[model samples]
Target: MGRKTPKSKEKLDKRKEEKALLAEHTALVNKANSQTNPLSSFPAFTKFSKNGLDVTLDCKRVADMDESLIHSIFNLEKENMKNLYDECSWGWNDKKKMEEMTEEAARYLMAKNEAGELVAFSHFRFDLDYGDPVLYCYELQLKQEVRRKGLGKFMMQVLELIAFTSNLHKVILTVLKHNPAAVEFYKALKYEVDETSPQNSVFEEECHYEILSKLNKKIFKT
Candidate 1:
């Protein structure tokens, strides 16, 4: 019997070229979409002050932020804030993927002292596709040196006012279950969890996060 003939090399090469072209086209489309996407631009200055501590909140507008500023705020050498949050909260440190997190972050708020050192930061976002009028707190980080000075509370108030004035209905955040102090702090701010958030249950690998929410609709009479 005659042996079956093999396919020509030219045909195989042509198929490979076609696949490569399609892949390249897809990548271009995704890049275009990402570039055209409208990211929320925050004001350069958002000031928060109460009692005595003075703080200035702002967004990191420059693509390349100062390393010392980040380190002073987070006590980490990394340039990306998301990686620091992951390491501190979840113990999953992947610096390379930090840019992806920024794309998801709708708004970033940073607090700095009078000496020009970053003290705290907050990452909040509106859902990209859900169209729900809610703001989600992606992460909230305060430098260890300033944690007990009521700065966190002031930051929360700033976020709350921003959410209310922006016509949002609610603001939601999550805290590790084991972090009792954080949980208590939210409670002091009148945040309550519903059926969606439970107590004494593991919500994440390294930590159990309790989803806390605060509604913006006025509930009291003047």
Candidate 2:
């Protein structure tokens, strides 16, 4: 082949740079997945004590978690989200939600009260979202008794701490627009709409969910 033009060569170089960045992000996620517990490095964060809540948190893979505990978590999600989910285009499906909860990459940050009762939990995974490694929070469900008592905020802080410390790009989660309380809770945490969040358009129906994210400014700014 004849020698390429400067512009063509620059384009090739840009593609190579993008490919390398994607590979790096994939590796970061793999490294995070290999860990038994992301919270191990931060022992102080494993306990929440305040607002009439006393709970100990632990991170475990679904494979390692007990079946009964998984069922409890599923029930909690169904209880807290079924009505709100039914309001959206994506109606509630028991099988689908349970499957998502037990997906191979799924990990749980579980909180148990003084009597060892399961109270609140966050389902999260380390994956490359839009080509950037992120801790995608699939679910954050708390029992009604534990709501508004600061435990939820504390749980999010723990997720952020693990994500940033693991070198992930950000912690992202989707909240339903109709769930004003959830929207306000994330707002209080300073999470903003992510670039990948969808918008209404003539081509598609309006979206009921908003993707919110908090980036690790120490590393992946901009």
lDDT (C-alpha) at residue 41 in model 2:
92
lDDT per residue (tens digit) for residues 1-222 in model 1: 665346666777888987786665444333323431112333423666665678887754223355465445344223434443464645655553355344533455678889887777776665411233556776677876667677778778767776655545567887766667778888998988843565564663443566788877753223
Query: Estimated TM-score per prediction?
Result: 0.60, 0.97
Best candidate (score: lDDT): 2
TM-score of 2: 0.97
Please, what are the lDDT tens digits per residue for candidate 2 over residues 115-140? 99999999999999999999999999
Q: For residue 85, what is the lDDT in candidate 1?
A: 46
For model 1, what is the error of residue 222's alpha carbon versus the real structure, in angstroms, after optimal superposition?
Answer: 14
Per-residue lDDT, model 2, residue 67, is: 90
Residue 19 Cα positional deviation in candidate 2, in Å, after optimal superposition: 1.0
After TM-score superposition, what is the CA distance of residue 183 in candidate 1 from its true location, in Å? 0.6
Looking at candidate 1, the ten consecutive residues that score lowest on lDDT are 32-41
Whole-model alpha-carbon lDDT for candidate 2: 0.94
Top candidate by TM-score: 2
